[model samples]
Target: MHCYIVEYRAYAREHLDGRWPTYSRLVSLGKAIAPAGPVELWVLQSGARPGSDYTLLASKMTSTPIDAFDVLPVECPRDNVRETPPIDILITRYCSMNSKAELIALARRMVKRRPLGRLEFVGPAE
Candidate 1:
């Protein structure tokens, strides 16, 4: 089995009004997919706000190490209405961005990791 890492941000919705499922929700989603295995955490970073320009860091309990990440930017309809752009769910699964190397190195690393695997789908966040 392969491991995964995921991050989220709000694009379509405004920062104050936008929303993303909680960590527990993600765990439940993972568990539903792979009932018998363990889902480890490499790193989980949720910004203070959509564009608050701040990051909140938490320590992992065990660190089994996440091999890849699947980030989904969800844009749900308000009052059962959908707009243009059709709510993009850009799915990019790649390795963790190393903090030491700066932006250029990080992008390079992401490119190298991309061909390894990719998964994109339209579904509700657990």
Candidate 2:
């Protein structure tokens, strides 16, 4: 099945209600964009790297669309916070792949370009 990686940053891990804003947004966007495919959302925290220091906030499959609320356990303020950092969202799509090397290469290319608020497609390696 096709997979989409939705990358974004977050200042606060969780909202006042203990729900992850990024995860919520990811599921919403995924349903809107690729309602029939698997969607993975990655959230990068402050002072964190792209591929390494990121959290798999949430993911949804075509079959289990209702179970997309899965999120990492993160602590946050109970009261309203101020001066939160801005987060940029980027979406990258990977077609069916046969090997792990192709996935690694495509991820490297994505890290280099860091496309923002756009869709990128990486077909299977030839």
Best by lDDT: 2
Candidate 1 residue pairs in backbone clash: 5-68, 5-69
Native-vs-model 2 lDDT? Answer: 0.33
Q: How many Å off is the CA of 31 in candidate 1? A: 3.3
lDDT of 2 by residue, 1-126 (tens): 323333334544243344332321222222211233434543433232332333224344446434333333332223312333455554332233234444333333333332233322344323
Kindly report which residue stretches of model 2 are placed more than 4 angstroms away from their true locations once superposed: 1-94, 115-126
Evaluate candidate 2 by giving its C-alpha RMSD to the native, one decimal: 17.8
How many pairs of residues collide in each model?
A: 2, 0
Q: What is model 1's C-alpha RMSD? A: 17.2
